[model samples]
Target: MRPGYGHTLRYLGAARGAITRRQPIFPTCYGDALQGSPVADITADPQSGWTGVHPAILAMNCLAYDAATLGNHEFNFGLPWLTRMLSAARHPVTCANLKLTCGRFLPPYLLLDRMIRSHDGEKHPIRIGIIGLVPPQVTSWDHLHLGDRLISEDMVKASRELVPRIREEGADLIVALAHTGIDTGPAHPFMENAALQIAAVPGVDALLAGHSHQIFPDSTVPGTDGGAVDSAIGTLSGTPAVMAGFGGSHLGILDLALRRHHGHWTITGHRSEARPVTSMKTGIAAAPDAEISRALTKTHAATLRLTRRPIGHSPAPLHSYLAMVGDSAALRLVNAAQHEAMAELLRGTAHENLPILSATAPFKAGGRGGPGHYTDIPAGPLKLRHAADLYIFPNTLCGLQITGALLRDWLERAASCFNRIGPDARGVPLLNPEMPSHDFDVISGLTYRIDLSQPARHAPGGALASPGATRIRDLRHAGKPVRASDVFILATNSYRAYGGGGYPDLPDTERIHTGKTQVRDVLVRHIRSRSQVAPPAGVTWSFASQPGASAILETGPGVRRHAAELAALGATDLGGGSGGFVRLHLPFDGPLASRGNDN
Candidate 1:
């Protein structure tokens, strides 16, 4: 999130912009979890964990951010760690929907008293109230850390309740920092994306939307094409709302025409836009801020040192370019690490007799982060930092004992990541837009097939889509069909076992063991325990064959280099795709496990 503070100062029609400027820029941030996503606040420095703040916070303070809010990723680390990080922010961090278990809540809104210059060279006083909101699904996504301690309320509901109070506090304007995306559909309780509904709230004058990382008012983006979002004018449901792109790629600017009607401050008309900060052809537009660079010198060096530490070796390349459609060497190595760690924890336990099924996911599947987001580690010596590329999140390990029926339901929920396809549907999208790539989990120790022609049993948010519907075909273990009454112990990360993805909820009794060790550490330990680690032999799941059907899978453009890999799976390269992605025509003609990690 390296943005040029000086460029923003020049674009806003100010002769001088600094600590003494009276025009008031009102520089507010939509929200991102942590700095750089370079392991989200983890560094080689000793004082940079739970007790110390990340360099990103220091950069924000140096750049002078007025206010900010929480994103779902903010809850990835436990509460103690998050509380320590927020204490370092120079600006107020507000979120109306977040409630703590101690019968208290974080700052819901901020009342800022500012002065703006009039047309006749006079200064006018304005009181602006900014209320913050995060997605209610934060609890589910970080269920391990947020287990009953923290609860997230619905976005629209919180706005309805808090906006009136802000107005009662004698504020002229109210802006909502809604960390969500624009949705034209009907508003429901506990919905993850709800900017369109929050915009319709009576007292809210304007809103800054985020969370999906899709830029509003941009016709080329996927989520902004809805009817409620007038992409031409940057308005959501007639409210002046703006959603900038992620990682500081774009800046959301909202210009309001202030008018005094009968002595009350009113907004007549406004201009809104999401401005790109850097161009792909020309690189960064302005000089790098020296203050920001100096503040991050120590952390940047520490991070580089952390990423370069060596671990072990690999015989074949590990990449996630084909994770969405086929087997992944990246995930295969993670599953092995998770299963090995859980075995040592359950060696003397009473549940040791039960079989352990390791569940892992493909984190770098080229979703919103663009085509270059996938992990592509070359064969040879491995480094400690490669563990970060393979296992992105800072999640801990946990083991859960559940019946076979619940396991099937878990896989069914993961199956909701794809859309329903018919036998005759050709060249349709292979993925569901509402589902994030992290929710697509591939569990090991079981062989199953997902039927794309059938409707998904659950929706993207874990709601029941079809009753008695089955998308998992022929679930089996050890070459035998699994029964509903059979029992198994699943070793997974705290996010999934406690409730990270929209999987089913299990009680405390169901959890056999929850380790305090991070999954990345377990991966490091597993790799070091062997002379040279190799990718798993076979895949755990495959697509159920559908005749004369095909789908398009968007991935990194680098997939073209693996020509023999694509030929083995009978996939066709559709060339460059929209939004800087490459398209692969998936015909489902052969088993995905037919090929290994070879070029």
Candidate 2:
């Protein structure tokens, strides 16, 4: 339910309108209903982060939804802010595993009473139950806002505890509004994607998965075939399930066939599939519902005004097509903005004497978002929209005190995003496809080398896979080797400081400061202070030399304009690939050399 952005909400209304025209439906959103990427942080009210409440909630109510669940992104602002947004939900927006610091407060599940007509036209009384659960990672992902103030229980554990209660309440059918992806693997504690396990929980009748942003029941999606998941018919562990594509692209539909047996309700058969609002593949679309556009016009106008506000100017083109491989001007801008603000705050503090480093990640790189997702800001005046592109999340500013030993470990975790490429290897995929681009944070104030020839020390989950493994080489600070005992004050978002994206678990005592000001606010300030900004072209890190070794790196098709930068790093363009991506043949054939200003 994107409000401030494009007509995705209108398309959502279109999907709802078309579906309901055939028959009445119990529409349920898995999560992330109130915001879209980039402009997602934009709220209806500036103080409220806008919450998308005016249109998101208003439109949800208009669509006549029975129930909706909270997504992990819902917690991005804070619990208090989220509470206010949820209060306006005309339909119940529930979350089972969420609770107040004091005790269980948010209702874990919701029940609905309705009359159902059987195939023979027999009307019977029925009670439907919905259990909502967000990813367990939210506790770590948004720990700064969730810490001590709220508690998030693991999804499967909470389901085991709450399912029986729903059954005892006389519910004939139960639907799991799981705001997590379907992972066919065996269940474990704190698993971020656990829909398959949730469906396996006894008494669970159906499941709806989200957060992965991929359509389930699509055979093209890996892990769906030859497993507990049956994508052809959209069943998980024999339970009807569907995961609608993300960003209001599709609507999931699950039809259940039920019959009365011995005075009890039983589900006999089921089918499920996702209906797309518009598809480039098939070139089909649902017409935009005019009511939603009319209802949201006022907010949309304000959004346009907000987006066009000026911030600063760019000296040259800044894009993230090359962010993952080498020096990225886009990322450098974010780090420079962060470094300046945190530096000012630390000036009068006790930890001011320590050298400062900024941790930043690439958010818009081409991955799950497809080839058009990478940031490409041409040289011109910077606006709020450009700033939003630089920093997608509405995370708060946080600073932590860390020893050099921990800093080295942090890089090891980030380095795991790449796949192991042995010496003299050629044409291997440089990145682990499962590794999200946002998790690959590169420290701005250091020079290091990533030896892809070595196995990753840390696994994608941020756990130590090999105790003695090392991928980061020649780690340095201020042109010298960093000692284990030496300390540094790190400038980062609250998400990273609290172990978001599986970086590390830092103790609360290590938190030197937690500023209420949003990181974007500081970035705006940093940009406005400068007449024109141009981040250094040099990179902070480089891949260790592997003569005769080349790897495949795909970026947005916009890479055609930056051919000169490609030559500097000894890379060649391989033209376009399916899904609008431009592939690159990055050859690590040259000798390793020093990079960036920190050196």
Candidate 3:
């Protein structure tokens, strides 16, 4: 969830209001109800709903018990809003691992004890120590808002210090609400993650794991150390770990079985599962939680009005074509916006004499985004929230001067997003399911073709030969090859400009310029100024030279029809074994060194 993704404050306030009014207290779930739909559209809130504190806090409040830890997406709103949200939480928000720049916990870990009813109908008091830990990546991704107020501490050291102390306080259960993810891929610290490490901590009974947004293959994951077990309810370090799915799509429930033996407690059994917010296997339905909605209605209204004000109109829905092989309506629009905005920024920079271009990866396109990733806005007014939906990241506009050689290498990285799949493929392909939304490419200002026959210069290595190569073959300028020495002024987000995605060339540029406006603002300005938007003129590509070309080649019927017309002219859909594309390389015959002054 983003900074204010939940209506947590309002939900808490409403719950408090109910308590003051002496009314029956039944919590209502906020946001969209899961009713067996594509996971992409599971939590569609155009404005006030999931964009801010509403979703995160609403979900946090729903699983009300004690303190909950913050996650990376929590900083999407920056520190001020996060602080405000944390301050407003009914229960103390604790994270011992995080230190402010002043060297102190934002909210110290709490020594909490509560009374519970045992299965035998006996009342028992249990001392439970809770500590929350958020991912430090927030400092890099959302630095604009965080400034210097927030700093993340080492998770291992934080757990190490707090464990013995909690036990000394006579606590029976040590619960770590770790926002870091677990090992979904291979089991390594970089891959397997610290959830296992946190679970292996002495005196820690259970671990509450969040952030990765995944389901455990089994209820119990063994700890690195013997005599310890990691369960969904809590980690064997002491207890199990549970993570409610993003946007309230699921409520993670961990039931722990504890038995008293010789006046001491022992965990008997435990289990955990992601209870879908809505059951879609049956049909689409509204399983709205009226109470939570009503509580947050006022706050949700203000946030929506603040963020969703219409900027312009679109003839068709501006949707994203994320992972699929075609440009999305929304992504194309953003690409056009970035292309235009970057060109303008370049014109004012020292590299104005060089050919200027802009490119952005479709971060929120396809993959886990599901079918809802498509940008299909009806012919209607456009709003800031709509723009937010188009460009989800809070990235700043940055420009770099890179030679065509480096530019090609960068494109190679973008092309690596695809993987080779065949009928006889073994197990799951090396393709990482969690390559992050922003890694997918959607280019503008330049047209190129990707050849899957070559290999990718993927991470930790430069380039190696492999049958599973993703290379740009027919990269064109006007109607010919782009010279190796061609200097291109590229406009991109600061994330890439600073080498965040391992695109080191962007940061090593000789000339770097940071723009005042954000990418989304530029897009909003572009749309409002245009007043009317149209579908892309045309974009195409091809890859039929490979072995498995025919089976892998496909596009929407609309694109296929256009391809047929293009094919009738001279372009044959080259049957490539990996995949096929309708070639759309525009002709740029302008002078190589033409400057804005000359124009």
Candidate 4:
């Protein structure tokens, strides 16, 4: 899928704030326009750095779509902005399945006639009837707004009603634009996705599905008869369905070959491809799409500027890379905030006397957040953007009650962030999501050892290293093994508390205490409570032993400045490699090379 001109337009909006809309907000639904710039607002480009979007959504308007459906991100900007944007769009936005009591289906489906070109250079007109539908689960994403709108009518039932009406209107073919995800394998009752359900609809001939951002190759939906199912427009059963990647990342191209016989057109051949946002001028991977960058440049610059504004002063800069190895400014800040929040929550609660400790991970650490994952908190007044940049996701705060056994399991899961070490090896991989850098568990009030020799017993199913496998052994709190039945209060985000991390026996949602506050608000409150927070006092965790050897992986062009300092401290600095990685000096004598490279 190609990004098309949308991204470029958005970039210009952000650069110049030319769009007549609100400023770009984090986790935005509207894209670069949130940051301001460009000539027009683009529905792609979430400022959080992900590359995904409903491709060429703008083209739907120019193509005079009978009725365009809504995708997941369409609601990302919240209802107000979405309503405004859709109102501004030239084409009518519609969804037969999602409607208000006033008879307006948000954007109701439209009826139209389209012109077509025959292979023989002949032009023809077709009476086509189209309707759009979306999944009901879209409510889960923006529950706040979705709460007000009526979310009833399943896609199947919706299609059954609308398709027949189109046919009655003398339209030859019934088309459905379903905003639903696809899973070809099973038909779980109570799990009626649009694709499978709509396929069974008698009146519909062709279907276009979005919200999955998936590309269908050769335009063929395999059938039980071991042959292609023919449709009025060609091979719509497998021929015409397509979804471009998200965020102006790709463009979906679908071509259909229709034949006329007995005064009716039938689809014969179908093809669909996901093309990149980059240029094909020379070849793939060579010409970076300037339009994409240009579209986002102005907005990107404005976003950076807005985020860079002074926030409340930090005595010590926060960082995630440091947290990856041991303690870091970013983790410490989170830990401090969580600790403060928990402490306040426990002030008069039943668990107040239990020597409370808060656990937090380095979520904003160096991986996807950006190259400079280090939070350089220069001293100053903090703003809303600063808080968002610091905490990112909209996850809520949740506290859980766990037994000592469960706590041990939790730490093991944290340790699992490290890779299984070869007998001759040492140190953990820098980016293990299970033991993901961000998920590195920090136990505030407990101290434990991570014995490298033992296999890591992370998660619940079974011993990840093998029965009795061990990475975390001899778990103790205050110099003694924790009692099995000893109940303790554990604080974590709502996402993990709901079994998001694959940790076992932790699916106890009843133990959860929801906070009406957002995570960023909690951090700001915690920071204000402290009046001043510092990086953790010291390293609370460390490697049991150096890898068979220790290696230094440098990062950034300015890494040399720290090289001499690290080498003098007994480490070797291996020079640079690919992925924007630089060399670091580490005294690693392991079987593996002592060099580290990172993008």
Candidate 5:
């Protein structure tokens, strides 16, 4: 389905119209069918009717798309369910790298024999080969579900091997549907951004890329070589490419002009671009397609009903506008839920005696998702939608055994979210824009302060930058300093525990428990189990005092209402920042009056 919101029906219609009158529109997707809904459970299976991507599949079938590819998120519900869903599509689902350990077969690529109209209005028969490749990181991201059931190959390697085979199968041209991002970094066996390398593969004519949720044909992206990307004229190693922005935001279009020479078809020229569904200047979106609206009426109604059902209550509001600045109630609640669930699961196990810690980050903090992305829930009945807002991904819960030193290192890596501040650099920006909000993790059950003056031990992407530098100070458990050898059980999602975000000190062998339950489901259950849930009041961590030194931070516009609360944490309202974010000035020497109490 349309992931978040936009007029997908109208977007698709516009995309269809962009092509030549007699040419067929090729629609492709890069996985992740659930969790993008403004309403939750649109991907959930209700007792009475079909759910998840069923409606989206129906819409695609109605549109008569030629073929599609798999994305990493497609396996969120597990392999069996994903297989069933893919099989239900009228169009072929092709992936060259995915392999099933259970002996289940999925074609490595798809070959389409179709007729195309040239500039002379003459139709020519052509065999077009489409190959799909997803990042191999899926094996780690979905380890619990796909551990023994399936495996994935490196995108570059898979493409190199499959492109020639597809060419030999009498195909005139080849198109790669790579669920990867474009980067000019040195090639690695399992690098996430392999689009450039994939493009260099022989016989590949055009490429459709995704998974970075970024738009090509835009000049915003910084290439790996430290240069601005001319996204508007997107290309990877001279091959025309387009990455449609996520969630129907844009449609990637690539036009190839072909010619027949010596009984062989070859691409002579090409053009590529991405079209947005919403107007950039006026902030207006296209109208929804009446036909698609009519087609999805029942499913949409059911999704709304299911998401609005009251599930629990919160004694205090849960918001994350100022999450990166101080202790966030929203993240605190999530940590509590993970801790509670993990504790219960280990009650009778040998590991029950170990202290339980939870690792959580503010997923809604404004970044790539834009300023309006913060989570703000009023104190009252909580709906499933609220829970989904609290924890966005469908990531499964996992418990890891780690030493105190390792935990400290983990926190140090997370502390890289902030920029190193100079003693006299008051009002200097404090955040590292390159660091994603998801990677700025805060650990519950431990008290520590991040000294922003010190160089961070790790870079934003989680690589070790300064091994000897220590930004985390006063790391303690139960009011006592944690020793390097002290062991603890950490409740985190499979992604972090399995080293998905480049977090250090965690090896998969250290995993003590992997729950089948999704973290969002755990949050819902935890909220329902309590009559009134509230985060412990006080700061878990705070900036080290630097008299007269101030730093600026950006948050959502709605944070103005909580100005006094922010002041208590040493932040003064300074109005707006760039990109719809509100700016706040925090004095390092100010008293931490709003610090939460440690339990």
Candidate 6:
């Protein structure tokens, strides 16, 4: 349901056209695209060509959404901007979980009385109740704006408290518009994925879930309990559900057959599915609706001009195709910029003398976004779009005071990106498909080696998996071994510093500095400060020497162009793997260890 900046107006127009043909469209959007910062400042002066959230609001208004919900990214521009956007919408915005401790501009739920055409061509009046839910982590994710002004209760708990009340208010059918994922893992108080739990609630007849940015009814999804999820028949706790992929890639549809019995309407049968705007195998590619495109033409042109504006120049090409293998120019540029910004921000503070370690992850490493998602900018003029591509999210820069022990634990958690490799299992796949690229953080101010032979100390969800296992080795800061008690101010995004990824030992008390500036802005400023930027060349960490051990890494297909550079790293081309990834074989030897030791 999240229509971010990635999709063009043309794409959205095409998606909307498909939705109208099915039924009375109840359009829903899960926020985060009014202003993506350095990428496209939609909030740039009102007199300017950029129309801020006007175009987005107009587009949704044209579709005539029955009701909508706010995603976590809705607060990217602060509560005031969001309040104005909501006010501009023709339809009401419902969010049951978000409590305004100070003031309220949105409703908790909306009841719509609609006349639906039954199977026999008879019109039946039904009261449809819609409730919206956003993740409770929004407070921590956008602490600068929300702080103590907003309070988000648990999704499941909120649904239980509000659903019955909505039902009592003459709601024939209840539809939960949850901005959460459908993770079937163990339930936690503030779990990011609470769709399954919410679906189990008695009054919830149907649900539309989002926020994981992944497709549902996807038969390929494996459950955490070693079971396969029948995503094709999207259901949670026997309740029909749908989760449309992000950026208007797909439109989720849930068709329910209702029956009137005992003076009450109930869902008798339901079918849930997601339709893609463009499908290669089915050979269906629809054109954008002329009306929608015409409406957004001005905003689209303005965004293009702003994104393509030259910011600076890079001496060498920046690409994330090989980021997982070693240090890439794109990641190095982000780390350097974040480090510089944090260093300056902490000046004159108590944390000024503390060593600043910038932690960043490769945003476009080709996993869920597919092969073409990799950031590959040719060496030449660097535009604002390039910097945006380097650091994708709108997360603000923050500094956290963490001990050496916590840092090592964080690295160990990052090391979970790789699958455990046995010494005898040669030619096995190295990267774990479950570990997201964003979770594989790499700190810039330290040197370490990851021992692939050892098991991951933490699981993908950040729980301790192997108690004594140690993947991070040779941990040193400034050529000296860092003790467990050594404290350092880590430069990271608000998400990580606020324990977004369930990182061990980081709490609000540890936060030392929080900057209002977005991280992408810092990257742009860092680039503009210099005429020609060249990132440092070398690998910070590498797999431990396994002698005869060999593993295959899957990356974007574009890696073939850098064959010579990859050969130097002892990686042999093994041709293409499944999806759009090219396989590269790495053979571990003593000489490779020496190359990995370079700072």
* Overall local distance difference test of candidate 4: 0.50
Candidate 3, poorest ten consecutive residues by summed lDDT: 8-17
Q: Which ranges of candidate 6 are over 4 A from the true structure?
A: 1-22, 31-41, 44-53, 103-105, 222-229, 282-285, 504-509, 589-594
Candidates' C-alpha lDDT = 0.76, 0.76, 0.52, 0.50, 0.75, 0.75
What clash count goes with each model? 1, 4, 58, 66, 12, 1
The residue-by-residue lDDT of candidate 6 on 1-599, one tens digit each, is 23542211000111111211224425555445454444235653343455455676777777666677778878766787677767777878888888888765468899987765544445557788888888888888788877788987899998999999999999988888888877666788877778889988999988888877667766667433422244646687778887776766677777765567666776655667776666746635568768768877777777677788899998788888888766677888888898999889888988899999889999778776666668888889999778878887778899899999989999998998888777666887888766678888988888888888888887767778897999988888988888999999888998787777667535668888887787988998999999988665656676677777878888888888776668777888888776547888887664444565653
Q: How far in Å is the alpha carbon of 206 misplaced in model 1?
A: 1.5
- Tens-place lDDT per residue, model 3, 35-136, is 111111113334334443443455456556355566665564455555655554565667676677877755546576655444444555667677667655
Q: What does the lDDT come to for candidate 6? A: 0.75
> Would you estimate the TM-scores of all the predictions?
0.89, 0.90, 0.72, 0.58, 0.89, 0.91
**Residue-level lDDT tens digits of model 2 in 1-599:** 12211111010111111211122447776577665554344563364334446467767767777888888878777777677777877788778998888887577899988766554445567788889999877877687667767777889999999999999999988889888876555567978888888888999998888876657777666545456788877788888888876666667777766666655777666668776656767746677678877777766776777778899999888898888887788888889888888889999888888899998999878776667677899999999888887887778888989999999989888889999888778999888866678889888888888889989887666667887878888889878998889899899998788887777768888988887777888888888999998685556898887877889998887888887877777777888765557888888765222243234
List CA RMSD, all candidates.
Answer: 4.4, 4.5, 9.6, 10.9, 4.1, 4.5
Q: Give one digit per residue, the lDDT tens place, for model 4 in 1-599.
A: 01121211000011111222221111101112121111122232244343322223333343333345565435533566566556645545567776664567564445666555444444455566667776654454344345557565677777777777777777755666666545443444323244656755787655665444333332333433433333222233443454443435444444444555565655544444545554535423435446555545654555565555444557654444344454455666776677667778878777776654567776544432223443444445665466665665455676777888778777777777655545465333434322334456677656555544555665321235454655654555655667878777777665456454445435445454656355666887766665566655644454454456443443443434444334433544455533334544433332122221110
In candidate 3, clashing pairs total 58
lDDT of 5 by residue, 312-349 (tens): 88877889988887888999999999999999999999
Model 6 scores a TM of 0.91
Cα error, candidate 5, residue 259 (Å): 4.7
